[model samples]
Target: MSDATLMLSGIEKSYNRGTPGEVSVLRGVDLSVQRGEVVALVAPSGAGKSTLLHIAGLLDVADTGRVEIAGQDLTDLSDTRRTATRRADVGFIYQFHHLLPEFSALENIVLPQLAHGVPRAQAQTRAQDLLDRVGIAARADHRPAALSGGEQQRVAFCRALANEPKLLLADEPTGNLDPETSDQVFAALMDLVRGTGLSALIATHNMELAARMDRQIRLEAGQLIPLGGAQRPA
Candidate 1:
């Protein structure tokens, strides 16, 4: 595969394949997302963008082929081992803010670090710094219930970043906000990740955003291909 922070080779996935209800989500898809690179995935609904993100993040296993994270093949690992690998290496961002409603912004970001056994003092410091960078330090004490949609998403970005992951997976991160708020949140998210040497694969329907990233790929009929296919360039 290409020199990448993440790789999925010859992957095939389907469900209920023996009957008329059968559906194939990905077919022999091969992809390589290199380190420190940001790639956008743009596709129509039902094209399996989310499915491909899930498989790449190790949240769900592929039915065939190999998945590699920083050169370690995970297709052979058990569920428990896979979970451990993901916790340490990958970060996820979703369209909706998945922050814990009961926890304050700072607490929400720190909780994952605590789960991984990081020192409470260090976790707090890092979480605070992340919040500040995301422009949410002022809202650090507020719970999700008290925050606006954009504010909450900003907090989620901090939470996703607290671990300093090798690769990031985002699914329509700005999908729920208005144009202005979405731009603000997206700016903060990119700024927080700037100079971090992190790799990212983001699924988006926004053509402008797709064009801004290092590369763009499309999902169609369960296959992954370059944007505009072979007509674009050599």
Candidate 2:
């Protein structure tokens, strides 16, 4: 088995296949994310970074290729098994926090764990610990509507890591925040990721933010190209 935490080989995906409106989003893309490595995926709005992330996270399947997570080839797994693997081994963060408005920050973080069969008390403990790590433990009881944008996003981060997944996939996680808040939240995220030793593939339009990760790869014309310097246009 490969030592990589996440691997994608010959990945291909297209929409409206065989039609004039068809758009190819990815083409024979290959990547490997090793354990504890943080990779920055740099791309503009129209680039296929989201599609690649979805495939890598098992939220969507590639038209052709192999996807391996922690040495397990999950490309052909059944939907149920895929769901299980996703729940057990992958965590995702998006541009928006997407926290449950009706639930408290702590509850929002605890729900996924409950769904995964973690006991309520244990899940709550883990949720609080995550909130503490992100420096938001004081806001644990507040609902999303009552929190600031940065606070809400921090809760979302806790929710994502509630399961302690082996791999993290984030798509413009700080895009909605202002620069100062983005930087603070991003630092918390990096700390959490590094502290737990999880592999990560984070997509970002900000070159400064991308440069902070361990390595950077730009998605252009449906293919990934390694970037030695972070000055490339996203």
State which candidate has the highest TM-score.
2
Local accuracy of candidate 1 as per-residue lDDT tens digits, 1-234: 456899889999998878899899999999998877788898898888898999999988788999999998889898899898888999999999889998999999999999888999999999999988887788999999999999999888888878889999999999999988888888787777665778999898888767767789989988987873212111
TM for every model, in the order presented, reads 0.94, 0.96
lDDT of 2 by residue, 78-183 (tens): 9999999999999999999999899999999999999999999999999999999999999999999999999998899889999999999999999999999999
**Candidate 2 global lDDT:** 0.93
What residue pairs clash in candidate 2, if any at all? none
TM-score of 1: 0.94
Score each candidate by Cα lDDT.
0.87, 0.93
Each prediction's number of clashing residue pairs: 0, 0
Q: What does candidate 1 score in Cα RMSD to the true structure?
A: 3.2
